[model samples]
Target: MAVTCCSVCAIQQLVSPYSAELSNGMQMAFLFALFTSAFCREAAKECRRRKKEYIKCLESRVAVLEVQNKKLIEELETLKDICSSKTD
Candidate 1:
């Protein structure tokens, strides 16, 4: 199989010689452990990056909503004042 990334290439290099000395089952187990740990490390890094982006997006959205809310409240107060004057 083609090496997809630096991590895969590193794993293959690290395991090739050691794997040659092991039984088939041991080779599979060793490969699985190495690959799983690498994948977990990559996934966590990706999650953290995406989480930062999501937080920035949410903060911008909140800022916009706050502005809209303030405008709506002003409109509401104007309407209330008009209604009270008409009733009086």
Candidate 2:
């Protein structure tokens, strides 16, 4: 990776500063390096994006579970009341 980075930097210098034109292959390598670097920078943001999505999903699930639990508790209390009245 370091070697590739160094080579890319060298190629960039050659193309930009030294007024030396690169061959088609070298130009392609340089463009690939630039794109790879850009993607690497965006990769961290992508990770954060996925994390946020996962957290949102978890929170929504939790909310749904909480509501379901409340409904179940209410049903259980109603059953208890009915059972007590039957005994009376």
TM-scores, one per candidate? 0.71, 0.59
lDDT, candidates in the order shown: 0.86, 0.79
Model 2: worst 10 consecutive residues (lDDT sum): 11-20
Q: What is the lDDT of residue 68 in candidate 2?
A: 100
The weakest ten consecutive residues by lDDT in model 1 span 1-10
Candidate 1 on 10-74: residue-level lDDT in tens?
A: 77688788876888888778878988887788889999999999999999999999999999999
Q: Give the clash total for candidate 2.
A: 0
Per-residue CA lDDT of model 2 for 25-53, tens digit only, reads 87778777776786686787889999999
Residue pairs in clash, model 1:
none
Task: Give me the displacement of residue 35 in model 2, in angstroms.
Answer: 5.9
The C-alpha local distance difference test score for the whole of candidate 1 amounts to 0.86
Give the runs in model 2 whose Cα sits over 4 Å from its true position: 1-15, 18-37
